[model samples]
Target: MQSAVYPSLAGRTVFITGGGSGIGASLTRAFARQKANVAFVDIARDASRRLVDEIRQDVGVEPLFLACDLRDVEALKASIDTARERLGNIAVLLNNAANDDRHRLEEVTPALWDERIAINLRPMFFAAQAVVPQMRELGGGSIINFGSICWRIGTPDLSIYATAKAAVHGLSRSLARELGVHGIRVNTLSPGCVMTERQLRLWVTPRKQEIILSNQYLKRLIQPEHIAQFALFLAADDSAVCTAQEITVDAGWA
Candidate 1:
């Protein structure tokens, strides 16, 4: 599939979380290809470094990679400041980092629950807080909060994860209403079962893949690039009027 080019994205500053691998990596590459100045935070040091090298060599525009744990709110804010100091005020913020480990309800201890919420839900709110000023200063900006279809479909073994994902929609809509006056658009981008490397390595057995395909309107599994393309549209000025919405690219799976 051919991707659309958005001239408006050229030279814009974009900040992404968990951008070292999986769907986050695809979002990094997609924004870079648009000639956007990209800066991303991830805890995976080796993969983040490699991503920087890859984009620098392949795209000719090197993205800034900061080693950060999103759970640390202060550290996350500091990383955003560093990115801003280097790349200019962020015009697009992609809250894409999330941990989706399967957990049985009975096995989910309080500690595990807290960690899951920290990884999947908390950072998104704080990240938006960190960047909203920049967006306000820029006159307008796009904030794409990554959500999942797992909760909506009531998938098994994801009690904590599903809870966090479901709450993401509320967060997005609340921020949209609160920040619209400042011209900062906040929307939740919920993706269906995307075939990321981690998902494949950890969960996607042949039988599981077959089940996923059988349930979806489209037989083919969703790819990271597909999600990236939708995100590009949301980030660009093309989606200036779109906000407070939950847009799902699930091939009619919902």
Candidate 2:
């Protein structure tokens, strides 16, 4: 699919989480191709390195890939600081790191629940907090928080994930109101049933695929690049007035 060029994104600084793979990788590539100074943090060192190389080779732009676990708040903060130092004041932030491993409610323990929250939700708030000063200093910026459609459609075996994702919209709304005065836009970008390699490997059996396509208004599967294109609009000045909105790119699913 062809992506629209956002001239405003050129030379802007963008920070993304989990940018080594899946939708995050697409986000990184999209921004980098637009000449944005992209910095991304991910625990997957090998994949991240390869992505940096790939971008450098493909677009002649090498994104800064910081290997840091999002669960460690200090490390996450440090990575953000490093990105700001190396790239510039971040004008866009994509909180795209998340784990949507399905688990039964009866099997969930307190530790397990906290772990899910740490990966799925906690880092988003802290990452936003870390970048607010930069955005404020720049006089404007965009924060695109990753959300999910599972909770909206009441998908089973994802209670913890759904809870965290539901909370993300609340977080976005509250932050949008607080930061709008500073010219910072906060909004949630929820995706539905994207056909990532991980999803195909673990889920997305033939029967499940049929169900997904049948439910969507569009018959095609949702791709990471599809989500990336939406994110590009959100990150750029094109969506300057769009804030506190929960935009879903599910091809009309849910």
Candidate 3:
């Protein structure tokens, strides 16, 4: 692992949700390189364990991995509490766990809409609610939520998902105002179409890929590392004064 580009996080602790694969896993690696005591949760047990093991070997620090579904608020809260017990104070939180249910507005049933909101939007607030006191005890922290470019572009078949992401942007800003007194900074990271495994398997056909790249000024897919880098910036002291803002990392697609 290379040395972290941002300031060292040798003594800080970070808790990231959905850290088994894709952008979340990339963030785990990046933070581990910075020497933060990282704790993450994922629904994929095998992938989460593998990532923790790999980080232990490469960075010589074992990140805590909790396998749980983010939609289960009780389970999610337990996971964070467990991680805190093991890793000390969680100084940074990456609320990155999300699911996109693609459906036209007319096709979106009540259950479907509620599920999307539960998985994508609810955890962000509940997780922050669970961790804010701990963060205050630690003298302040950073809370970074994952938003989506779909919200800005009005993508097809993504009405519910886009709405949920838009809620995240609003949530971050409101939380920033609410938490600022405790020195906790809140921000949102809105990623464009990153070439994650899920995108490769389900979302992006070759033709669709071409269209996406063509829309970008860079004419290339956004990598997970790119988002991870921005996450590190927001996590570290470099973004100390930056809060309540949505930073887009989409290769100029949005």
The candidate maximizing lDDT is: 2
Per residue, candidate 3 scores C-alpha lDDT tens digits across 1-254 of 25356665677889999998999999999998888899999999998899988988988988889889988999999998998899898899999988874777788789988888888899999999999999999888999999998967878888878888988988999999999999999999999999898888987899988999889988877889989989999989888889999999988973
lDDT of every predicted structure (CA atoms): 0.94, 0.95, 0.89
Worst 10-residue lDDT window for candidate 2 reads: 245-254
Count of clashes in candidate 2:
0
Cα lDDT of model 2 by residue, 1-254, tens digit: 56699999999999999999999999999999999999999999999999999999999989999999999999999999999999999999999999989999799999999999999999999999999999999999999999999998999899999999999999999999999999999999999999988899999998999999999999999999999999999999999999999999999973
TM-score of each: 0.98, 0.98, 0.95
lDDT of 2 at 237: 94
